[model samples]
Target: MSEAERVPVEVAVGVLVERDAAGREGRFLLTSRPPDKVYAGYWEYPGGKVEAGETVEQALARELREELGIEIGPAHPWQTLVMDYPHARVRLNFCKVFDWTGDFQMLEGQQMAWADLPVQVKPVLPGTIPVLQWFAAERGHSGPTHLD
Candidate 1:
């Protein structure tokens, strides 16, 4: 394909579920990509690609149930970001999930973590970096760049 040819962008949804710690800062959930998937072992918000005829919300709900074994509640549409990666271009639709039902489970056998700003997790997915920066900015912290 020519450089000028437009690359098709995959529409993906991301769920940001934050947990408020008593008398401390809140933390958001991040899951490790399955070993067989692209960017294996990279941490990211819980979500998946939007299927045909599915709205962003619908996709989020389905993904959460399948991946985390929870029914999402009160998810607020947050941000839309388009990022280019060597593997694929994607348009990410992010949602801020305030509530959910059921105990969190790593259904896909991936590691999960509740991370605070300036995430201590190494090698987060490139598409997720901007979202983390935004989250940090919301918490009054300077966003770190890829080099940080």
Candidate 2:
């Protein structure tokens, strides 16, 4: 396909799970994409697109289980951001999980870390950063879209 004709598009969702740290709450999990994949080496929220026949919640639960080996409970809509990249456009839905099970383990051989939102890292994945900042500012996923 021609470069201009190629459809550069993708859909992804991010899971925002927080925990109390040192008596202060508001921490989210981020994972590093493997060096061999697209946007690799950059830190990103763990999620993928919503596939046909599957709801957003289903996609989020599946992605979390597949990528992090954690089984998530009910998740509520957090935020949605559409981003455009050189190769594709991504519609990212950020979800918040109030409950889950299992230890946080990397099912895809990626590195996972729980950090305070609005991370200090320079330039995170375009779609994921916005939600991250929202999480940091609000200290949760459910809130108004003041920073979008």
Candidate 3:
């Protein structure tokens, strides 16, 4: 394929991090993707593409800051999904962000909902079920990259 004939595909990473408030563990946050966008009305983790000249962590932090208005600290790499959409194929590199500087909120106009393990989350997105199962298997207060 010629360079001009080839179109660039977008690579985005959606992070699924858990937090514990009070004595309850396995608290995860989910946000709905805008209806106007590609994956409209679908619930997903708040993250975006790995931009040029930026690492995965850097891109994840940048995207989270823009999406949730929170500064994430150490994040553990999780599952990766390569799906083919009608327009393009996206490489979703999921991560678990446990440590951060500030509190998390919906910076964008998207809706945010918090869920606990096993019962709180649902298979909203097609690719999210596997990740959710992985999260459910490893319910703990401590943070670790659990991708089974």
Which digits, one per residue and each the tens of the lDDT, describe model 2 over residues 19-134? 56554445667788877778886778888867788888888888888888888888878787767677666667677776789998887878876766336553366666677556
lDDT of each: 0.78, 0.69, 0.66
Q: Which residue runs of candidate 1 sit more than 4 Å off their true CA positions?
A: 2-4, 19-25, 143-148
Q: By descending TM-score, how would the candidates be arranged?
A: 1, 2, 3
lDDT of 1 at 147: 37
lDDT of 3 by residue, 90-120 (tens): 6777878776777667766777777654434
User: What's the CA error at residue 25 for candidate 3, in Å?
Assistant: 5.2
Clashing residue pairs, candidate 2?
8-88
Q: List the residue pairs that clash in candidate 3.
A: none
TM-score: model 1 vs. ground truth: 0.86
Which candidate achieves the best lDDT against the true structure? 1
Candidate 1, after superposition: displacement of residue 109 in Å? 1.8
The clash count of every prediction, one per candidate, is: 0, 1, 0
Give all TM-scores, in the order shown: 0.86, 0.77, 0.73
What 10-residue stretch in candidate 1 is worst by lDDT? 1-10
